[model samples]
Target: MKSLKLISSAIAMLMCFVSMAQERTITGTVTDQSNVPLPGVQINIKGTKNYAQTNYDGNYSIQAKTGDALIFSFIGMDSQTIKVKSSSVINVALKESSNQLQEVVVVGYGESTSDYSTRSYDRAERKKAKTAATASVALQGKVAGVQVQNNAVYNPSQNVVIRGAASVSPKNEPMYIIDGVPAKANQMSKINPNDIKDLKVLKDAAATSIYGNKASNGVVVISTKNELYKNLTEQELDKKLNIMPIPSEPTQEDYDSFVENAFESPRTAPLSTFSIDVDNASYTNIRRFLNNGQQVPKDAVRVEEMVNFFKYTYPQPKNEHPFSINTELNDSPWNSKNQILKIGLQGKNIPTEDLPASNLVFLIDVSGSMSDANKLPLLKQSLKILVNELRQKDKVAIVVYAGAAGMVLPPTNGDEKQTIINALDQLQSGGSTAGGAGIELAYKIASENFIKGGNNRVILATDGDFNVGSSSNSDMEKLIEEKRKTGVFLTCLGYGMGNYKDSKLETLSDKGNGNYAYIDNIQEANRFLGKEFKGSMFAIAKDVKIQIEFNPKQVQAYRLIGYENRKLRPEDFKNDAIDAGELGSGHTVTALYEIIPTGVKSDYLAEQPDDLKYTKTETNSNNYSDELATIKFRYKKPDGDKSIEMVQVIENKAVALEKASDDMKFSSAVAWFGLKLRDSKLVSNKSSEDIKKLAKEGLSNDADGYKAEFIRLVEAVK
Candidate 1:
């Protein structure tokens, strides 16, 4: 009987493993009965929060387990439900429904062709608003995450901004569509509340991407009960909507251009110096591009950021320092002849209750460009998550900027949770951005409420589109550089797309002695703000710099991956005035270097220069032939100014790729994938399949499922 029980337990364990492995990626296209692609079709996995929408090409990819049900829905189209089976691809064809065709309208992109509507209010629901003073007021309780702000003292008109929908313009107000004719926010109240038959709101990028720049603040489609337009056909509706074309605006998204690091002879340049980067924005931003079926721009693929996003098993610091250093050597997966070196830093983890008090100032951008669901709205949600994680000893203040900057809330104790949330909820996006003014005021507030030895920081959340006073990148950089001298660090949380200015945010974080992250979705907010609150909120070390000297005796040529923007002169490593990146509590940073051993012959090597006729090259004679490289780290305490240094030596031995640790393998895979994305000459022949296979080999300790997600992203690339 005991043996029988043991056999049953073994079978149960196998079943559990099978169930965990059953969750796989599902990809397909949504089309109409005529074989025309239907973009913005909302696909939801039944009984779960997992949801996705078709891109411009009507393509989508989602994750689900076997036997899961997926519901495909669109406006004016019959919704269909399908059960997941063994197949990974599920194409759906939605049929048009005449019954509800005239009752509602769906608008996407600029294609007059209706595809989907996220939220709608029919006549029955509209009746609830009949008692309200205006149509905008009626939508107060009807729409989710929608707020109607009325500055009665200044303006009588209600400023309606959707907190659930994201936009990328200075016009924070929603665009009004009256019977297919576009109208302005002021005209929203002019329309009689009783004349509306149906009202729908489009908030997601998939639904709004086609609407162009004018709709960046979101679009509200309304169908009036006018008998004159009651019997109009879909073609007539298109004609009426096309009366005014979407405003033409060039894409203002900005990313700094950088050339890949080229291999350098150790004999000529032995030291590689750079700041330690803790920012993981590039990885999440890259995932956003892949998930949307868009080609990632080469500038967006920061190899160091990608490799450092995941956590590794580095031991904690037992010494007086705030972080631990680790190193590993292994065969390069992409190039068999070359070797790869991994350097990792693990910041000491401190429990939230035990950490020092925090003095945080939420410097939010409520400009017109931040009106989108993902911008101001998502920003609010992300902040609320952090608020819940705050302790009573911590303190927070709120400052906002648009046309001007001012404090909305004074320094309040973290225990007043609801009060802080109420202030965040009341914020409305409008006017052009004055990021410089915002920074000035935020730093002032942080300094006033300084918690001597606590974590004092200004959290700036925005799309980085500063357009009003002092909006130039140079102006912002100088402003931030001055603010850092106050000993109050900065943290930039970027949101939205299209007009996103990554270059500006990066500069602010780098010069202000802080970290930067891009929040793409609510899930990302939870990941960066909720699960990793300690690391994202508190800092343990500041001005962290790394310098490594490769011995020519064991290494021929070497190149550091990424960090093109963070590189520093060898002399700057010891300069206390020189600013660098910060290491947050419990945060981990990883950097990789591709090295060519002394005997290896490769194409990457440049032609040798004239044999240096006057200078004879010297080889290491210190009897340290087994040492491949010596690395040095410099960092200052969170509140201290002077820097301390640490050193570690990497052995010359290289382990086989298959025998390397999961972290070494995973980091190598990430670096290779980043190189592949950038189309780097070093990895020109490497394919996506190669990245996927390498990533799979590093999935042993992925309890958080991030490693598995990385593999799926690799496979998603076309």
Candidate 2:
């Protein structure tokens, strides 16, 4: 019996050793010599079928055992081989190959000969093309480095390698420009190969050079005979696509255009009414543009968002109201002759533990457009971070939309984090974007499992490339408007770059009484979803509106910076039927107004029109000359429809620009940068250097380091 026990112990010990030798998941990032993330870098386990490719953020996870050799390869970069050691994390920075120039042609357009390797498959030649479901499959072996893996009759996947892998993006997928507009490679899955007029694959760098970094992997130009009209203008194309623009890359991304606000005479328009904005999508989107070495779009530069992106040191609300208002008047940094008035609102902060129970629905887009590594993959990672912050009382449901909308995870307690994460992991991207359908299903789930008087919200994550049912901006706006009455708020989190639809997402969030943010990287995910969980998930006030009554005695004319889209009719301020912005717990909102002092001469102020016929202008009888502006605001409780009014008066006082608080200086610098980006005629001759100087002055004890990042962004402008 003793001998038998010893034998059993030996067997158990051997089993443990064998288990330890089995494949384990290893994760790491790949970058270039300059520490820039390299997407599409191919990583493989030597002598094994296990492999993984880096996502848009240069991150990857693979199944490999200890002591196994891993090979990393990308075109134009030196190959690297590393053996797994004790650590599961392996990071590699590849160096450019010395003989890369000989192998790769420089990508440029308008060259003398335009002699770069190019292949064209005209309609006549492709008449007998294989009847494949996807464009990639149809092109099969015709194009070099393009291979189709037929796993099953129903699941045939294609992988296109254009002159090997390029680390320009997170994935090795080439940019697909359909007609004159740029699109994602996976979008071609929806197009019929028979409808293709001319399919040309540009393999040389010179042919793809026009697209800059977006074409690092290569460029595939597709022309559809029946679908697209040749030589359509940008406006016509945008109208035809029915998509909003997300400006960054020179792509089909759309943005709403608006002329700059002209100086308004307090005498003509006494009440300046508008909604308070808390969304910061514009700022981060602009940052992506600057980081990618592209010009920032003028319409994309929303000054209010840029100013509010950084955290401010405003005092917490101490009254019955959910927020506290503070105002400061200082000399305008750009126009020395004019004064800049800063209005700030600080929402009451609530501790995470004391926050109410949350019934959160994650509305994720798993469409073909979201197939980019930065889109679906990054979104999953971001949501996981939020899951970690959930408390036991909090519940989460996941609703995904592709060709249709469906619920993936039921309402599960936040404590069941592993289960939620597992569901997220199983999600794959394909099919058209039925964004409107997705929103309907998400709202249904939220309403069914409604947590009365608790934090009920739907967080929509997508690139906003909606093409299927109810996808247009007007349709989405009307849909969200109806849903906002359900007392369930919405939050739009935008991801990806090329072919991003910022306008649609903006409309959904704006009408749904929610906030919007653009998640550019994992760090931004941490900032928006993790670090700002209390503020992002819990709303202190809803339908918040601001109406400023300028004092004609102390001010001549003033123009509110940004908030152009949020402008409300003078009578809309009191109407409870109209929707406005929301204020979250611990959130801070800042607005700047360029004011021309009563006697100050300014070029921005157009010649005052002659007195209106048969109209008499009446001045305030309250004799409040000591006040520069009377600010009246209204807000409703998160669950209430009625708004409570509050009023504050800005004293007619001016402080030197140097005497302003750090927040004032930093926010001003950001506003200046925004105006500069927009090429506004209001700004005096100011260089980026001047803005950088002002930002550095306000770089006082920035714990989050956001202020420092702002300074760096300004430096990247030129």
Candidate lDDT scores, in order, read 0.80, 0.81
TM-scores, in order shown? 0.69, 0.72
lDDT of 2 by residue, 320-401 (tens): 9999999999998999988999999999998888889999999999999997767898898899899999989999999999
lDDT of 1 by residue, 252-365 (tens): 778889999999998999799999999999998888777644678789889888988899999999999999999999999888899999999999999777899999999999
Candidate 2 CA-lDDT value: 0.81
> What stretches of model 2 exceed 4 Å from their correct place?
1-249
Model 1 whole-model lDDT (C-alpha atoms): 0.80
Model 1 TM-score, all chains together: 0.69
